[model samples]
Target chain A: MSEGTVSGAALRILAAGPGVTIQDAGRHGLLRFGVTGAGPMDPLAFALANKVAQVPDGSAALEISMGGVELEAVDAAITLAIAGGNFRVTLDGQAMPSAARLTLEPGSKLSIKAGEEGAWCYLAPCGRIDIPAQLGSLSTHTRSGIGGLQGRALAAGDVLPLAEPKVLPGGAMEIEAPVLKRPGDVIRVLLGPQDDYFNDAEIAAFLNGPWTVSVRSDRMAYFLDGTPLTHAGGFNIVSDGIAHGGIQVPGEGFPVVLMGDRQPTGGYPKIATIIGVDLGRMAQLRPGSVFRFASVSLEEAVAARRAEAAEVVSGWALAPLVRTSLSSEFLLGCRLVDGWVDALAED
Target chain B: MSKPLIEGAIYDAPRFLNSGETALVVEFGRSVEPEISDRVLSLDAAMTALKLPGVRETVPTYRSLMIHYDPLVIDRATLIAQVEEIASRPGTAGGPASRWVLPCCYDPEYGEDVGEIARMTGLSEEKVVSLHSGATFRVYMYGFAPGFCYLGGLPPELAVSRRTRPRPPHPPNMTLIGGGLAIVTTFSMPTGWWLMGRTPERMFSPQREKAFLVAVGDELKFEPVDRDTFLSLDARAAAGEVVARREALS
Candidate 1:
C-alpha cells in the first residue's frame, strides 16, 4: 500500500516456473524480527534486466527459475526484457532472443523455457509490476509468504498491472551481458567468526572438497553435499544474527549456504561466508553442479565487490539494438539523465 | 505484571565473530542468563547511538548481537574498532523495557494440544492452565519466524521436554510451551513445541506502522481469557485495533 507507482495496463501471467517470484532490492533492516532479506537471487541479473527494459531504478520484476513462464499482455502495450540464465523465449510461434528488450503488443502470447545455464531469470517490464508492497518491498519470500503478487508464486491467470505503462513505440535494444562468471565451480569465501570452531583439518576439508548442490535448495539456503566439517568445539554456538551468504555447519556436518531468504538468526556454527560479489554466480549454479569453496581475505572480498560494481555500470556487454514488429525506443531521445542509448546501439 | 530481573555481568570481555565482510557478532556468553541478555541490549543501544559508518542494522539476541552493514561505505577494521570502542564505553547500559499483558484462551477447542501439554508436564489440566498462565515470561529474542519472540522465565516445576514428533502445521497466536520455554507465534509454523493456549492478538502485522507488538527485553505475562472474549478480541484485532495491552514497568 505504501508503493510509489500507480498501475496502468495489466500483464497476464499464463504460466510460470517453480522458483518464480516478484523481487525488488530487498526488505532490509528487519532481520531483527526474523524476517530474511528476500530479493533477486542474482542482483546483477536483476539490475541488468532493469537496464535492458530502461525502467526506473528499483523497478520490481518477476524472477523465473527451474522451469519458465508463459504470459500475455492484456489491454495495452508495454516494453519487456528477459535477462539471466539465458532462457529460451518464443513470442507467438516465433523464436525470440531472451535477453533483448522488446515490446509486447496487446494480446501477445509469450512462452518461456528455462535457461540451459543458470537457475534464475528475470522478466522485467519497462513499467514496474503492480503489487502491494509488504515491508517496503515487492520481493516475495515464498517460504514465509510475505511478498510478491499476493505473497506467492504466480500461476495461470494472474493479471499483473504495470505500475507506470509506457505507450507502444517499444523496440528491442540489447546490452552486452556483464561478465558475471568466476571461472569454473570455485566459490570465493571469507573465513568466519566460527572458523575457530573447527580445527585446521576441518578447514582444509571445507576448502578441498567437491560439494554438490542438493535438490533441497531454495531461496533460503543451498544445502550442499560435501565433506562434513567436524566441529572442534560445540557445533551449537549461541544463536546469532546471520549475514547474507553465511555458511552454517550443524552437527550433521554438511554446510548450508544461506541465501537471500535465509533465516535472520541461527544457532549453527558458521565456518565461512561467501562474498556478495559471487553470490549470483553461486546462485546460478544448478543443482547437482560440483560446488567448490576458496578462502579469501576481507580486503580481497571488498576489492572484488568494487570491481563487480564497476562492471555493472560501465561494462559494455550489451547485445546489438533492434526494433521488433511492436518495438519502440525508450532509451533514445528521452529525459533519462544519460539521454543516450548505451554503447553499441545499432540496427 | 513482573519483568525478568537483570543479573550482574558474568563475562569480562565479549567475544567477537566476523559474520561476513558486511557483519559482525558480539557475543557475551553461550548460556541464557539475564545479564547476558542485558549486555546484548546495552551494546545494541551503544552501537546504534554511535551511528557507526556503514552500520545498517543490528539484531539483538539473548547472548549476542549481529550488526549488518555496508562494506562499500565503511571498512571492516574501522567498523570493528568503532564497535569495540563504543561497547567498552561506561554509558553503554540499556534503559528499562516495557511490560506487555497478552490474553490466552486455554479451552480445548482452541488449544488442541492442551491435553497433550498437561500430560507431558505430568499435571492436571486445570493446574496446567493456571501454572502456565500464572508465570511471568521474559522476551529473549525474535527469530525462527517473524515477531516470534523467544519467551524465557518458565518455572522449573512445569518444565517438560519437546515433542519427539512435531505438528504438521501449527496455527499462529497460540501460546506454545516446550523445552522450558514459551512462545506466542506471530504466524503459522510447524513446531516441536506444544500448544497450551491460543490468543487473538496479532504480534506482527505488515500493515501496522510499527510491526512488532513486543520487542526483546520486554516482559510478556499471559492473562487467561474465555473463548467468547477471545472471539470478540480477535474480531477487534482484525479491524486494525490494538489488542495487546502494554504498561510501564516502573
Candidate 2:
C-alpha cells in the first residue's frame, strides 16, 4: 500500500481527547515557506515514548494532552508505550504503568483516562504510525491546517495505519523508573539578547512578579497574566527571529512564552528566555498555575544539563548488574580464579 | 550588472543559541520593515541555492532568517560567515514579484461586517465592494498566517481602520482592510481588519505540489464573483484543475 493509505485497521476516537494530535520531531526550517514547526510541546516526553516502544527516534506518535483518549486497537499486533505526564491507563480492565512497554494483541481495547497531574502524555507504537509527511514532517500544525489527519484534531472513526512489526531479539528493555514529583512553577531564565529593551525596574518586576499561566495557552505559546511590565521604550521593535522560550512582551505587557509551534519571527520585545532545562517543567504547567522567573547564568544551565547527561550514562553503566545475584565477595573470588587460570595457561 | 550600494543599510553577523542545540538564528534588523524582509529573503534564497555546508534548513521571516545546522559538523562562526557572504552579495536588487488575480465573493454571509465597514468608510456596501474590486494590489508580504498575502494597495475611500473589537471567528479567504491597506488571507485568523468579503480559493494547500499560491511582491487583483462562481472556482481549485495565471506588470 502507498504511504498514508490508512490500513483497514481503525482506532475509534471515543473521547476526542483534549489537545491530542499526531506529532513527530516537527516541521523544521520551513518558515520561509510560511510553515511553522508544530511538534510535541514536551520533546522529552515524545522522545521517551519512542525510546520505550523501541521505535525510531523521530517516528510519529500520539501527543495526548491531559488525556481523555479512548481507542481499541485494530488489525495489528503492536507494542505501545506511554510517557511524559502522569495519567491513568487501563488495558482490558487491568491497570498499567504510565511509562512501561505493553504488548497488546490485535483488537485490544486501550483507554487513557484524564491525567491527575501534568499536562501532556505521549503514546508511541513499536512500528511507526503511517502518516503522510508534509514539508518533511508528520507533525500536525493545527493553526495552518496542514499535515496529520486533515490538519485538524482527530475525530471519531478516524483510522490510522501502524507500520509492520520487526521485533528485536530482546524485545524492549526497561529503564530506571523516574521518581515522580509535583512540578514546581519556578522557571529559570537567562537574560535575552534584547534584555536591555526593558528598564531595571521592569526587569526586576519580571523576575519577582507572580505571573499566572493564562487560560489562553496552547502549543503556539503560553500567555502569562501578571503585573504588566512597563518598559521605557515603545511596543514596536524590529522583528527578529524568535527562539523557543523567548519571552515576548506584546502590547499587553504580559509575557508570552513562545512554544514549539510558535511563529518563526516576531516584532515584540523579549525580556528573557527560559532555559532549555526548565522548558520541560514549563510544558507541564497547568493553566492558572502561578510562576516566578529565577534568573540564572548560561554557564549554570550548561553545567546542569551536563550533570543530567552524566547521570544517565552512569545509570546505564550499572544496568547489567541491576538484577544480578552476584555479590562483591563472589565476584572478587571469580576474578581471582580467572587470574590463576590465566597464569596456569601462560605457564 | 554593477552592484548598487545601499547607504545606511545595517547588516549583522549570524549568531547561535543552544535552544535546540542545532538551530542558529541569523538576525538582520531589530524592527519590522519591508527592507529587512527583502534582505532576509534574498539571503535566504541564495543560501538555499548554495546548499551551504552543515546547513540542514533555513527559515526567513520579517527580520531574521533562522538557519538550522548540524552542530556536529559546523561551528558557529563558519555558518555565520557563510550567511554573511550571501547577504553581502548583490544578486537581485529587490524581492520576487508576481501578478495574481484572486476571486472574492462579497456575499453578506461571508462578509459579516460589510455594513460596519461601510459605516466607517462613508461608502455604500455596493460602493465598498466595487471600490475594493476595482483596483489591483501589490503583495507587500506574506505573514500572520500561512500563505496569507498582505496587499499594499486600496482605494482611499475604502481605507478604513480595523474593527473596534475583533470578531470571534473570521472565515478563511477573507479580504480585509486595516491601517490604510487591504489584506487577503489564505488561512483562518482572527483579525482587526475591516471584513469586506470572502473567497472560496484556498490560499494554502499543504498537499499541493506548490503549497503557497501567492508569495511576497506578487501583484493581486480581486475579481468579483457571485456565490455560484465562488463555489465552482473553489471546487476547481480543490480538484487541482485551476492553474494560477500570472500576467506581466504593465
Candidate 3:
C-alpha cells in the first residue's frame, strides 16, 4: 500500500524447500479476535538481519527452516543479508557469507543448502517486500489463513516485489561477531506462576533433566521428551492466556514450550518461561538436540534481556553501506565476510 | 436467588507470574466461575478504557487477564498497581446481557451426531432437537476459539455427557452439548461435545465491521430449521443480510 513500485528482479524459487515463510515482527494485540502474532521463531536473528540490511525494524524477511532453497534474481540489483543459525549458503557456485550484507545482481542464483546446526535462518533484503498487510501485520498466520503472500509460504515461480534501490554513502560494514556454539545446550528460564504446582524434587528434576526436543515441535510449541514433573494437583486448570516461551506441563508431565504462533490461550499448567534473551538459543536447537534448563531469578532475566537489547541497539548505530559499482569480482570479495572466512579457515 | 459474592484474598498490589522477560501474567483468581469471569472482564474493560501507558494489550479469560506491556516503557510494579486499583474499584459490575436467536439446521446430514446425542440423552432425535430449541440459554463465556460461545442452562432431561473420545476435528458452527452446557463453535476446534446441529451463521469474522456475532452475557435460543431453510439463510447471510435477530423468549 506504500507507493513502492514492483521491481523486475523476481525471485524464482527452484526448490521451494521445507517450511519457508515470509515473516516480520508479527501482528500484535489481536488475540481477543483469535489471531496469534505469527512471526519468525527467532526474533533476535530476524532483527539482526534487518539491522544488517539497514531495513526498518518490521520489514518482511524470508524465514527459511532447514534450508534447501534455490532462487534466481530476475532484474533489479538488491542488498540482501542472511542471519540466524549456521547454514550452508552458496551464490553462483561460490560460498556466500552469513550474517553479512551482500549486493545481489540480476540473474544471480542464490542457493541455501540444508542447515547443519541451527533450525531456522533469516533472509532480509534492503527495501521492504511489498505485500498486503492483514490486521495491521504483514507476518503470515498460516493457521488463520491471513497475512504474508496470500497467507502461505513461497513456492516455485513466485515473484515477490522489492522496493527500488536508493544510494547511501559508504561500503558494507560487518560487526565483530561473538563466538557461538554450533548447537546451544543450556536454555535459561525464569520461574513461573505455576512453579509451586511442582514440588522441590520435581523442580530440581526439571532444572537438571536433559530434555530432547521432540519431533512434534513446530512454531506453535516444542514438545520436550524428558522427565515427567509430578504435580500434587491435577494438570487440568481453567483455560488461561499463554505467552511465548511459557513451559506448559500437560497431563503426561513432559513440558511443552509454547512458541511464536502458539494458541492465544491454553489450560495446561505452565511451570516456567524461558528467559527472553535465551529464547533465540532455544529456537535454534534442532529437534533431537538435548537441552538443560537453568533457572534464573526475574531480576537476572531482566538484566540479561537489557544487556542483549543494548548490544543490538549499539549494533544498529553503525551506518549501512550502499554499492554503486557492480563488478562480479568485487561482489565476491565482499561476500567473503568474517563469518565465511572463519568457516573456510576452520575447514 | 443470586449467589453471595465470595471475596478471596485481595491483593492491594497485583502480583506477577514471570512469563518471560517481555511479558507476565497478572492473575486475578485461581478458579473458573461466573463471578471470577465477571471480575476478570471488569478488569479487562477498565484497563482497555484507561489505555495505560506502555500496556500493549490485555486478554481476559475465565479467571485471569494477561496484560502484555513493553517492559522498556513500564515496569511490572506500576502495571500491577494500576490493574489492582482498577480491579478494586467499586461498581465495576460485569457487562450487561443481551438476547439472541440462533437458527440451526437439525437435519441429520448437517447434524451428523444428532442420533448419538439422542441416544445419550435417552430421547428421540426430534425430541432432542425440540428440547434444545425450547429454552433460552445464558452465555457464560466466549472463548476456546474466536467467537465460540459457552452457554449454560440446558434442560436437565436433555443434559448428556460429552463423547468419551473427542472428534478429531469438529465442524465450525456445530452446536455441541457437554457437561450440562452447550457450545456453538465459531471456529473449527476438536471437541468431546455431542454435536446436535449446525448453523451457517458466521459467528466469528475478523474482516467484518463487527467481528464477533455474540459476546459474553448474551442469551441464545436455538431455532430448528430444515435443510432448505438453512441453505437459503446461508445464502442470505453471505449476501450481507442481517438474518440474526433477537426476540423475547417464547
Candidate 4:
C-alpha cells in the first residue's frame, strides 16, 4: 500500500454469462454443522492470482466459469492481474496477455471470454476487493448461497467495490502460471474410505475406462458418463461424513465425485478420491470432456499439493514486464467530464 | 469394515479408513444405532481434545467420524496412529449437551402430511400431533444440509416409510416424521419424508454468531402450537428476533 489513498470507481458488471463467483482461500471448521468449506475450486490458481497482483493470498478474486463478463472501473486507477484457463481477455478491443499486471483507469473496459481449453478463469486486482464475509470467507457456495457478493453467481448489474490498489510505482508484473494439464484422458485419484466395496476387477474397470464429464455437473459434484464402477454387493454404507473429491458409487453404479459445495455427509460407498492437486484441472474441464482416472498413492497426492506450497516462498516471482494502455476511447469520454487521474493528482 | 462378535458387542477398536490424503473416516460399525452415534461423538470429542496440529475439522455421523486435517503438517500415518491410540482406550459415552423445546404447528395450513399420517394409522390428526410431540428424541447427527438433523425415537404407531416420490422445494423449518424417523429441515431442499408440522424457529441463519441452533448430541421435543402462535413466532423469526428456546441439559 502506498502513502496515497486513491479512492475511485468500483467495478460494475455490464454482463455476466454464468457461474461467475467471488472466491478466496476458504471457510474452514464448519463441517460439523453440515456446512461445506466453500472456497475457490481452483485453489492454486486463486493463490497465484493474489501473488501475481501482489495482494494477500486470501484476497477476494473472481472465479468465472465457462462464461464471459463485461466490466468497467467506475473511478480511480487500479492495477489488474488475470490468470487461469486459456481465456481470451481484451481491454477496450486490444488483447491482454494472461498473468500480466496493468493499470486500469476509470472507465477502463475489460472483457473475459472462456477459452476452449478451460472452463474457469480468475480476475484479480493488486488491492483487496471489499465484500462482506460469510462464515469467515468471501468464497461463494453457490448452491447454499453462503457467501460472496450476496451468495449467488454474478449476474448483470452487480457492482463490486474494491479497496485501494497497492502498486509500488511499478510498471508491469508477470506471475508464473502453472501449466494446467488438461489431459483429455488422465486424472489421478487415491482409492479410499469404501474402496473395499469394489473387487479387483471393478477397480481395474475404473482405472481402465475413460469417463466423459456429464452435463449434470456443478460445484457440488460431477456425474461422469461411463461404465459405472461396480459395487460387488449393496452400495450402502453406514451414513458417514464425505470429503471433497470423494468418488461415491451409488446404486446407479456411477461415481458421483463430490466437490467444494457437497453436503457434509453421504451414505453411498466411495471407492476413490481425486487427488487435491488435480481438482483445479478437473474444475477447468467442461461437460462432454472425456477423462480417465489413474490411481495414485496417498504419499504421491500429498506430496504434489505440498510441492505447490513449497514453491510459494521462492517458486513464485515478480518479473519486470511492460504494461501497455488498451485501445480506450472511454478515457476521453470520462476525460471530457474532467475525471482524469492526472487532473486529480495535480489537485 | 469388520463386524464384531455377538458375545463381545462393545467395539474394541475403530477401523480408521482413509477418506483421502487429508482425511480419515473412523467407522464404528455398519448400521445406525444410538450407541454407534455415542462412539462417534466420543471419538470426535477425544480427538479434538488432543488438539493435534493440522487437524482442520470433523463431521460426525451415525456410525463414523470424518477427521479433516492438513497433510503438510501431519501425515496420514501419524494422524491414523494418533486416532488409533485414542480409540483403544475406554470410550466416553457423551450425553445430551443441550435441550431445546420447539413449537410445531400441525394445522392443515402447516401440516402438509398430518392428514396423510392420521388416515394411514387410523388415528386422528390430533393423535398424530400428540404422538409426535409426546416423546423426547435425541439428535443422532447433523448432515444432509446445514442444520438438517437426523433424529431418532419416533414411536411405532407414527412409523411410515419415506415417500417414494420426493417433493421438490420442500419448505424449511418444517417438522417431518417419516418411517419412524424425524427431522427439522433447515434448508428448502427436496425430501421424500412425510411433513407433519412447521416450526417458527429458524434453526439455521448465516448471520448469527452460532449459525446452528442444535448440535449432534442435543435433545429436542416438539410442542404443538396453534396457527396464531405459529404465525407470531414465525414473524419474529423473520424479523431477526431471538427464537429458539433452550435449556441446560441436567
DockQ of each: 0.42, 0.30, 0.41, 0.58
TM-score: model 2 vs. ground truth: 0.79
Which regions of candidate 3 are displaced past 4 Å? A1-10, A164-176, A179-183, A316-347, B1-16, B121-131, B134-146, B149-165, B179-182, B187-189, B246-250
Model 4 chain B is weakest, by summed lDDT over 10 consecutive residues, at B1-10
Per residue, candidate 3 scores C-alpha lDDT tens digits across A1-347 of 11233365555577777578889888787776556877889888888888767778868888887845777666766667777777777766666445555655566677776556788888888776776787788887676666878877777777777666421222244333452232478888887767777777898899988999999988778999987888857777666777778899988899999888787777788888888778778888889999899989877887777776676666443323333366645544443333343455677
Please rank every candidate by TM-score, starting with the best: 4, 1, 3, 2
Give the poorly placed runs of model 4, Cα more than 4 Å off.
A1-5, A168-174, A181-184, A316-347, B1-10, B118-127, B156-159, B178-180, B242-244
Better model by lDDT: candidate 2 vs candidate 4: 4
Chain B TM, every candidate:
0.90, 0.73, 0.79, 0.90
Better lDDT candidate (1, 3)? 1
Is candidate 3 or 4 superior in DockQ?
4
For model 1, how does the per-residue alpha-carbon lDDT over B1-250 read when each residue is reduced to its tens digit? 0111233335577776777678878777766777788888888888777787778889998788888888899887787787678667774445447888888898998778778766776878888888878888888888877878888888776678777777777777788887777778878888888888888888887777777888788888888899999999999987877788898885
What 10-residue stretch in candidate 3 chain A is worst by lDDT? A166-175
Better structure of 1 and 4 per TM-score: 4
| True-structure RMSD, every candidate | 6.2, 8.8, 5.5, 5.3
Clash number for every model? 12, 5, 1, 3
Residues B41-137, model 2: lDDT tens digits: 7777787888877787776655567676655467656777776677667745364466777778888877777788888878899988888888877
Tens-place lDDT per residue, model 2, A1-347, is 11122244434465666578999988875665557777888776677677666677778988887746877667644567777677777765556555555544455567776566678778887676776787788898888877788888776677777766432222123334442233557888877646666888899999987998899999889999998988666766644556667788877789999887787666677778776556767887878888899988756765655544444334221121123376754543343222323455677
